[model samples]
Target: MSDQDPDIWSGIEDLWAWLDSHSPGDGQQSLLLRMLKLSEEVGEVAEAVIGAMNRNPRKGASHTWEDVESELCDVVITALVALRTLTPDTREVFVRHLARVRERSLGPGPGPRPA
Candidate 1:
């Protein structure tokens, strides 16, 4: 959190612009494609995790933890890009939703103790 750090919203905006400009389809179709990209990124993450865990006998230890980490980044980037495609106010939308989620799980008040 410093002046040197790049703003995430700025990066999101830049990515949205780049994709929107290069996209072959119209707006609606492009948005749908972006949404589908999320699923693809998530699948990659799952594949990376499975490979790292050696969960698949046929491809034991095929991926390293670094690969899993990179895939996780891809999932985040894809999700953010999809959100940006859905709306121009991506930062506000994400922040409000995140606040609501945080409040629901860990609100301003404390919970009852275990009996």
Candidate 2:
């Protein structure tokens, strides 16, 4: 994997590139497929979190909150990569979708919120 800036955005791009190599952007694949992949990654995060919490008795467990955090970031980046892959116009779609979600959740807040 190519080294990029350590920001969340770059991490997302890295995951996207990895996904492109792995799956090659099949338009026939359902959104559910991507979502399932994202879910699997998140499940790994849950496992790590559980390990960090000492709920699981695994050998040589050095897991910490920071470890779980990076795993969570991995899950988020994987999900975003899937979204960006499925929707090429991701920025606009994300903006529009977030607007609709925010409206639904917050009862129509101020318009055009910053990223």
Candidate 3:
């Protein structure tokens, strides 16, 4: 996962700026709207997963696993953008949280054991 990619965050910031310019909402409202977008993106991921799995009888295998992967990327991008909306220092916040999660899950070692 290229979560550390500078270009990804740069693109997200550009998108956030464009969105803010177009929508022109207050801070709290903007944050709420951004947060809500996460759910929308998450739903798209679920749809893609179902399509890839051929779960829908009428539209069997309508989407590929690649499509599901793209949708999941969208969900991640949406989540990161929402986090940025809450604070300008989203990278730091994310890195800190990731560290905590790593410590908890990996016990401060080389990392979690492979399954």
Candidate 4:
């Protein structure tokens, strides 16, 4: 993954800006719609993976692991789009969420707290 290119949260910010410019009416887009779209992208990834893994390579049908990976990226993009639609400041949200997860993973620092 290129550091120059925005990661998922940064992608969300970019998507939010695009939506801001386009002004998708009333901000009433359904979450189900976004999820369904993401699912479709993921399905493509799965299909390509299955083809590459199980079927013999043919003359015209060139399905490879790379194709599956690209489709998986599309699924990630779709997910970022949905996340941006839900939260404007995805970076901050992600940072905070990450901090919480880290804290949980690390547990409370050695203090007077009981085991």
Compute each candidate's TM-score over C-alphas.
Answer: 0.88, 0.66, 0.84, 0.61
For lDDT, the strongest prediction is 1
Whole-model Cα lDDT per candidate?
A: 0.91, 0.74, 0.86, 0.72
Q: Kindly give the number of clashing pairs for every candidate.
A: 0, 0, 0, 0
Per residue, candidate 1 scores C-alpha lDDT tens digits across 1-115 of 8999989889989988999999999999998999999999899989998999999999999999999999998888889999998888999999999988998998754666789
Q: What is the lDDT of residue 27 in candidate 1?
A: 91
Q: What is the lDDT of residue 35 in candidate 3?
A: 89
Which of 3 and 4 is the better model by lDDT? 3
Lowest summed lDDT across 10 adjacent residues in model 4 is found at 53-62
Candidate that would win on TM-score: 1
Alpha-carbon shift of residue 26 in model 2 (angstroms) = 4.9
What TM-score does structure 4 among the candidates reach? Answer: 0.61
Model 2, 1-115: lDDT tens digits are: 3465565555566766676677744655745677888889888888887878878765345578898999987776767777877776666777788988988988966668799
Pairs with steric clashes in candidate 3: none
The segments of candidate 2 whose C-alpha lies over 4 angstroms from its true place after superposition are 1-18, 21-34, 59-62, 111-115
